[model samples]
Target: MNKVFNTRYLVHLVLAGLFSFLVFNLTYAVRPSDYDLKEGDTTSASGSDDPDVYIINEHGYKRLFLNPVIFNFYGHLGGFAKVKAISPSTRDAFITSGLFRNCEANDEKVYGLESTGEDTSILHWINTTGAQAVIDDPNFFKKVFCINNNEFNWYLKGSDYNSVNQIPVYSRDTTSTSTVRVGIIEFVPQNVVYGDVHYAYLKKTSGCWLSSGGEIGNYYWVSGSNQSIHSSDCYDILETYSFLDIFNNLSKGISKNVQRTIYGEEDTMETLHSVYYIKDFYEKEALKYGVSDLAIDIDVKGPYMLASDPPLGGRWGVGEGVCNASLTEFFVNEAISRGVDESQYDVIAYVYLGDWQLSGRSYEGFTSCATGSKSFMTVTTWRLPQEDEGVVTLAHELGHSFGASDYYTSPCPQNPTLWSCVKDPEGIPEPNKIPKYPQTKGCLMAQIIAYNKPGSDEAGDATSISNLNQAVICDATAREFGWR
Candidate 1:
C-alpha cells in the first residue's frame, strides 16, 4: 500500500509540471507585445482623442491598432499630415513623422519625427525642432513641410525648392499657376522617394480649397493633370532658314560633266538646280499650313581641300570616310567664309567629297541652339549623291532645324531600350513642348527613303515634298513649328 501511494503521488507531480509548462508557452504566444497591429485594426486608445489611430507604413499601407495604447504618440491630428522614409537603406521601415499646421495666414510650423531602427520597436527618435524646420535632412519631411503665414508664404514664393528637390504638395488655389505649396507631414521614405508625386484641390462645401489627405509620394487622390504645375504657351511662329554647303573636291576638275555626274543630272547648272529643288520643296510643304513664307535662299560654296592635319577620325583627309563635330564645324566655317550669313540662315546642309555609289552611306545630321530661341541645323555628306537619297538626307537634316523629332529608336542615357532624338526625358521639349507624334513605320521622320517611291526617275523626289506617303508631318511637329 505504501509503494502504491508513492507511485500515484509521483505521477500527479509529473502531470502538474507539464500543465504549468503548457500554460506559460500559450501565454507568451498571445502576449500584447507580440501582437503586430496591421493597417485597419481598431483598438482602444490612451492619448488619442478619436480613440482610433491607424498605423501607416512607408508604402502607405494603413492598419488599425489592436491596442491603441501601443502607439500612444499618435493623437487627434488636424491640418496636413504625411509619413515618409527617413533612410534609404531601410526604406521598408524607419519612417519619419511629417506634421504641420497653418495657424494663420502669415504663420506656419513644420514638424518632422523619425524612428531610428525598427518600426514597432521605436528604438530612437529624430525630431525637427525650432521655429521653422530646416531643409537639412535626407528625408521628405523637410521638403514637404510648410506654414501658410506671410513669412512662410514669402519663403515659398522666394525659394525654388522644386528646382533642387521633388516636392509633392500643390497649391490650394487650383486656378493659381504657382508651382509650390505649404504643408507638413511625416517622412515615410518609400512614399516620398520613388514614383510621381500627385496632389489635388478638393472643393469643400464651404467653398474653400481643402488641402487634406496630403501624401508624400504617389497617391490615388491626386489627379494626373494637377501634378503638372507649369506648361509653356506655344503659339509663336519661328522664322527658319536653310543654308546649303556644296562640297567640291579641289583635286577634281570643275567640268560640266563632273558636276552632272556628281549631281546625277545632265544639266550644267547643278548647284542652281539643287538650290531650286530645296526651295520649292520647303515652299510647297510650308504654304499648306501658312506657318511662314518659306524663305530658303541657297548658297553653294567649296571646291575646298581637306586639311593635312585632320584633328580626329581622319575626316576630310584626301578620301578617308569620316564625319564628326569637328568636320561639321569646319564645313560651317567654310560656308561663313564664302559669305553665307550666320544670322540669315537657321539650317545648313553640307555635301562633301565621296561617291554615293562607292560609299552608299550618309553621315547623320544634328541641330545646335545656343540662345534657346532658334536651332541651327546642320547635315553633312561624305560624297555627292548619284540617287534620290541625297535629297532625302538633306530634307531630314533640315527637319531637325525646323523642330521636327526623329522617330528612330536608339539607346539613350535616360532610357536604354529606345529614345527619341528630339525629345529629352529629363526636361521640356525643345522649340516647344508639343506632344510628339506616334512613331509610324517608314514615315519621313523614321527613315530617309520615300515610302511610296514616287518620282523614282527624278533626283530629290524621295523627300516628303514629292512623296505623298512620306509627306506627313506629325501634329506635334506642326505645332512645334507654330504651324497649328
Candidate 2:
C-alpha cells in the first residue's frame, strides 16, 4: 500500500471535519538518522534505544520530560513509537529549555519553569487556561498570574504574601503575535504544549479484538485471513470521544460521561463524526465556562436509538411535554433505565430534524437546567433543525446538568454569580450578592432572546456563543466548582 495514500485516507477518515474533536496522530516508517523532527515529538540521545525523551518545542529548544508520569501526563504513552532515536549531534542541536510543565486536567492554569541558568528554575503561574490554550499565546496577561491551588490557598487564608515568597509576576506582553513574552521569559506558541493533549493508543495486535459491545468478537485480526474477515467485526470500537468532555464538565467543569448512538442515519461514520461534533461543541461550552481540563469520558453506543426513537414531540416546558408531566416522565425513565448517574453525568437524547415533528410547527423538547431538585430533563428541541444546531441545543440542556439556571427564568433575588441582570434583555436579575469576583463570564446561560432584545446588556454580552472563548467562569459558579 502507498504510505501516502494510507496516510491521506486515515487522515481524511477523521480530520475531514473534526479538528478539535481528533488529535489525528498518524505515523509511518521513521528514518531515525536524520533530524527530520516534527512538532509534538519527543526524542532522546542516540545510545540505548530509549533513554530520556524531551518534548520537541518551538524556537530551537526541547523541554525534557522529567519523569515517566509527567510524560504520560501529556499522553506521550499513546505515541511511544514516535520517540525518535536522535544522535548525540541531533541531541546537542536543540538547546534545553525548561524542566516541568504541570496542570491538572480540570484546571485552567498552566504552570511552567522560569530558569535561573542553574538546574533550578522558578515556577511561574501561566495566565492561560483550558483546552484551547495555544502552545503559547503572546497576549496572555494577569495580575494574579497563576491561580493554582497554592495561590488559591493564599487567597483562602486571607493572608498577604511578602515580596520574597511571591512567585515572579510576568507581564503577558509579546514582541510579536507569534511569540509570548511573560515577564523575562519569551517563547512562541510552538515553544510549549499549553494544555492537555490526549493521544489514544489503539493497535491491532496478534490478538483478539473487542467488539463494539466491548466483548471479544468471534473474529480475530491476528492473521492475514483473519484480518480480511474480521476487519469490520470490531470496527464499532473505533470511537471518537471528547468533549464538549473533549472540553464542558457541561458548564462549570466538574465531570461528564456522554454516550452517543446514531439514528435515522445509516452511515457508520456519522456516529464518529457526531461524536467529534458533540465533543467539539461541548468543549467550546467548557472553554466558555473555563473547564476544558475537566475529565469527560465518552462512550459511543452503536447504531440504535435508545428506547426506540424517543417521542420527543410537543411544546417545551419544565415538567412534561404537553403542559403535563408525561414529557419529563418519558426521558427520566429512559435515563434511569440506562443507569444515568444524575449527579455525575448529564444526558441528552435527540432526533433527526423532522423525525419528531407534530404539525407545521416542529415539536420541542423538555428542559430543566436548575429547577429545584430535578436532576435530568433530557430532550431539547427548537432552534435545532440542523445537525450543528442540534448539538448546541443538546449542549444547552446539558448545561442544566451543571446546575446553571436559565437566564430566562428568574429575575428577583438574583443569580449572584453573574453581573447584575437589571439591564437584562429578558428581565433583570438582581445584582450578584457574592462578595468579590475573581473570574467572570458573560452569563452565557442567558437565553438567546435575552441578548437579541432591543437593548444592550450593561452586564455584558450573554449570547456570544459564536464568538468562541469570548466567555469566562463567574465567581459563584467557580466557587461551587471549588475553583475559588
Question: Estimated TM-score per prediction?
Answer: 0.28, 0.32
lDDT of 1 at 210: 22
For lDDT, the strongest prediction is 2
Task: Itemize residue pairs with steric clashes in candidate 2.
Answer: 105-293, 242-246, 243-246, 243-279, 244-248, 244-279, 244-282, 244-283, 321-327, 369-400
lDDT at 221, model 2: 16
Which digits, one per residue and each the tens of the lDDT, describe model 1 over residues 283-308? 33432332222344554444344333
Candidate 2 regions with alpha-carbon error over 4 angstroms? 1-293, 300-314, 317-325, 334-362, 367-389, 407-441, 447-470
Q: lDDT of all predictions, in order shown?
A: 0.29, 0.32
lDDT measured at residue 398 in model 2 versus the true structure, 0 to 100: 39
